[model samples]
Target chain A: MQPLPKELLIEASGGDIGAFEKIYRATSDYVYTIALKVTGNRADAEEVAQDVFLKVFRKLGKFRFESSFTTWLYRITVNNAINASRKSTRRRSGQVEFNDNIEVADGRDRTREAIEKEQNEARVRSMLETLNPDQRACIVLREIEGMRYEEIAEVLQVNLNTVRSRLRRARETLCSRAQQERSIQ
Target chain B: MKCTEARELLASDFLDGELDKDARGEVVKHLDACDGCRRFEEAVRRAAVDPLRNAPRETAPPSLWLKVRLGIEHEQERGVRAALYRVWRSFHVPWTAYAAASATAAVIIAIAVLREPLTVPGSTRASLTDTEGLHEYIEEQFSILAYQDTNGTGNGANGNGADSVNFGTLLEEYLM
Candidate 1:
């Protein structure tokens, strides 16, 4: 993604609503995608996304443009999603139930594709659930978001070695689990 | 590198291209010589990619922007209310202090004004005795006292009213 315009960031920091709206339009999807992957549920993702943006709005004035806006946003998104995921877990106590009323077009092929897509999404979410929040975040950033190890470390506010260890452990667990499932099948 | 070290690198650093030059050379040399390390590398790569490739890219709901906008509005309102509360609190202490001081001053002024009635002599209180009325009242009281004394209406025969009047006249004269 391209960096946000400096003029727009300055204007937004000065309370220009129009400029802030433009900034939101540019980055909201990026924010939402991260939140969705981290939280693994649409409602929780949306809530996390809202909180991230609200925090961004409140703290924009303090941004000194030292890092790219996307990097700053990534940090905020990851932290908020982690917190939201933990809170959602505590609130639901491992018994999260999602509404299954997805709207689908009327056709057999379309219905099959939707079902496959939903199954794939559920499988991915379950795979992510095996790791702790920190490991999950590092894996999601590295694998899904395609961020570098250094970038992941910066966003997670940890050392590079920590990022490496977390990713290694996460991948090892996932590999063993996948093999186990394959053998079971 | 040992097979164990190569396997550990394959899990993350080798796949991610994060291994240092020397480490990468060592792991690559081991992978080339060991079938198990190659298989392990492939397995780890697959494991890392499978879930990420399958995970759907969900766009936020269309109403998400509206929700965010509403959230910003609510936050701004809360900020304004907080600021106003702070301003009110800042003034509250001084306003309370001023009110207490004003009440004390009013009490003092009231006491000073009311003290005149208590300190006035009884003869002076009976008439608005400025100058002429004061002189005439004093002379009339003295005459009444002398007449009562000469008539031998001494303490046994005279009523308490006459005794009181004489006493009042003497007290007023002494005060003057």
Candidate 2:
């Protein structure tokens, strides 16, 4: 993600809507992406994104320019996504919410590449769903976002060892799941 | 390093490129020596890390911005309404009426207290708070007494003659 101008942040913190819009436009893709990846659902991602921006707007005034804005944003986004994911998880009683079989609109072109991409997406979602929320968060941050372990620790407000262990355990689960799927195939 | 330790490193720091030079060297050496650890590393990459790393980036829908904007505007309106409500509530307490009533009551009490001296018919109590006035008042009371004693009657020139007769009989009457 590109870094936002400090001036824009200042203006937005002072209640400038135009500056805030720019900030949103610049950061919303990654924010939404992070939310979607963590929650494994578009609807939940949308909700989390909306919540994150609102919270940012409300608390922007108190934001001391100490840390990178994206880091702060990642923290809020991940926390909200994790909570939403957990709620949906509980709502469905352990059933994963990422439905690979949902009907796509017929008007869209159904190319072979598109189908493969969709399948790959579904596979990734299934693999992610095997982990608990914390492990999933670590995987998404470390794997998807390519955030360093230290940055993940900062974002998740956990220690480096904790990030390491979560990633280790998460990948272990994924490797095992991959092996199991291969054997079944 | 054992297979377990090397595989753990592969799962975490090795794959993530967080390992230091010395530790990474040890893990690489272990992977080179052990087939199981090398396969585990490849599996970890194929299964977990690579899929996510290569997953296509998605943009937020255009509608998301609209929703966020509407939410922000709604929240601002709600905040303004809440602030206005606080101000309205403050004024709604009838503080003006309360303060007016309080001031009126205080004035009435003050007037009633102050007017008592005027109603006493030559009452010296207000002035008696002054030392000179108190001395003059006591002297006048004594003169009135002396007159009544000489006249051998309760009637004195000051027309407090009745008061003079009863004045010294009780300490309360004397002070009055």
Candidate 3:
């Protein structure tokens, strides 16, 4: 995703409430999606999104515009999501609350397609839970966010080789788990 | 490339298109020759893509924006409170330390003042006697001075009075 223009960021940094609101509206979904994938739970994802934006708001002035705001936001979101995921794991004993009430409106009066979509999403969320937080983050960023390995390295603050190895191991684990599920099916 | 090497490359760098042309060619050739490697590659591809494509792009709930706004407000509130708290603490800590030190010094001074007389080695009654003896010695010295003055001057009024009052009688009278 493209970063917001410098002028808007400057305005927001200058404490313009409207400018910050626009920034939030522009980026909250992206942040939420990442948080959801990494955390694999809606509630935790929401909390993570809340934390990321709050950090952004608090630290907006410190942003030097040296890097794209999206990259900076990604770093914040991923780190907070990882921490939130760990806390949620410990708190819930690995029990993800798959609350079905937060369904996306498909405009089909909740038809089969909507049900299938919900099921697919639930399955994907469960699959994401199989990997550790780091691996899940790597895979989510690489596959879902379509970030390059180098970019993932930058956001994850790891070396390129580490990103490669993490992606490889994460894929291996995920593939093996998929195969197991397939065979079971 | 051997199947092992190609599988490693295929899983990550190859899938990511990060492998160089030559490495890519070798992995491709291996995949072409080895059905197992091809299936593994396919499985990895599926594993990477299927779930991601199916996983919905969740919109931030409507309440999320409200929550974030409230969070920012709360953060601002906290920022103000924290600034005020720091200011309070900055002044409070030193004053508290000074007050504590002053109290300690006062206690020490009081302890020293109150303890000095009690800490003396002699008994209280003996010290009273010593005070009485000092008073008696001072009275005797005064009496001798008065007697010398009267006798040396040959003043009968004073001489007679001094002669009439002996040291013992004078001391007894003073005591009485």
Candidate 4:
């Protein structure tokens, strides 16, 4: 995400819809992507994104400019996604399966490339489902969003060593799952 | 470095490029010596890291922003209603206080009036009768006064040769 201007944030905090819309346009891609990756399903992702933006809209006034806006937004997005995923976990099965026939935002592509992209995304989502919400969050932030360990620790509000351990555990689980799937195939 | 320790670092700092120069060298030495640790690192990367890093970035649906805008508008409307209710409650509370204060004042005044000494004419209140021997004492004093008046030694109406007043009638007139 690009660095948002302090003036823009201040304006949005003062209830300027146009300014807030700009902020949304700028950040919604990563926000939606992170939500999708963490929750492992489109419906939950969409719900999480909506909730995240609403919270940002309401609580923008309290956001001190001392930290980066992306960090703050990422924290909110991850927390909401994890909570949504956990709740959906209790309501039905353990893991919410990613919908394979997910509609792409870019309708321009009906080619094999688009299909490949969708399949790849589905594979990633399936792998993420094998971990618990906490480990899944660590994987999404570290692997997908490309956040540093320190940044992830700050966003997840855990110590640095905790982040390291979670990422290690999550990757190890993914490795075993992959091996199991390959053997079965 | 042990294979177990090398594998931990490979899963985290080594793969993330966060390992220090010396630590990275040590892990590299261990991986070079251990085929199992090298295979484990490859497996972790293949399974977890590469696919996610290569996954396409998803955009927010066009409807999401519209939904959020509508949600915010609804929230603002709810907030306005809440503010109006608070205002109404503020006005309502003072009237309740006034009513309570008026009822309390009325009760206190009623109690004070009931507790005052009775001075009504011909009134025979139970409280007066309940006093210890007060009725007998009053009757005796009236009898003495009547006797004195009859002998023309008291300033009473019966002193002018009027028949001595009946005690009960005098007592009633005194009350009046």
True contacts kept of each: 0.72, 0.88, 0.78, 0.90
For A29-87, candidate 1 gives per-residue lDDT tens digits of 87898887777677788888888888888899999998888889999999999998887
> Candidate 1 at A156: error in angstroms?
0.8
The lDDT per prediction is 0.80, 0.85, 0.81, 0.84
Q: Each prediction's TM-score against the native?
A: 0.75, 0.75, 0.71, 0.73
What would the per-residue lDDT of candidate 3 be over residues A26-134, giving only the tens digit for each residue?
8888899999999887778898999898889889999998888898999999999999988788553344542644454443578887788778887788778888999
- Comparing 3 and 4 by TM-score, which wins? 4
lDDT of 2 by residue, A17-131 (tens): 9999999999999999889878877878899999999999999999998999999999999999989988897553333432543435431668878878887877787788899
Q: What are the per-residue Cα lDDT tens digits for candidate 3 across B68-102? A: 88988887889899999999887775678889999
Instruction: Report residue B59 deviation for candidate 2 (angstroms).
Output: 1.3
Candidate 4 per-residue lDDT, tens place, B35-129, comes to: 99989889988888898888878988999999999998998899899999999987785778899999999999999998876653554533454
How big is the positional error of residue B81 in model 1, measured in Å on the Cα after superposition?
2.3
Interface RMSD of 1: 1.4
Error of 3 at B166 (Å): 54
User: Model 2, stretches more than 4 Å misplaced?
Assistant: A90-99, A104-109, B90-176
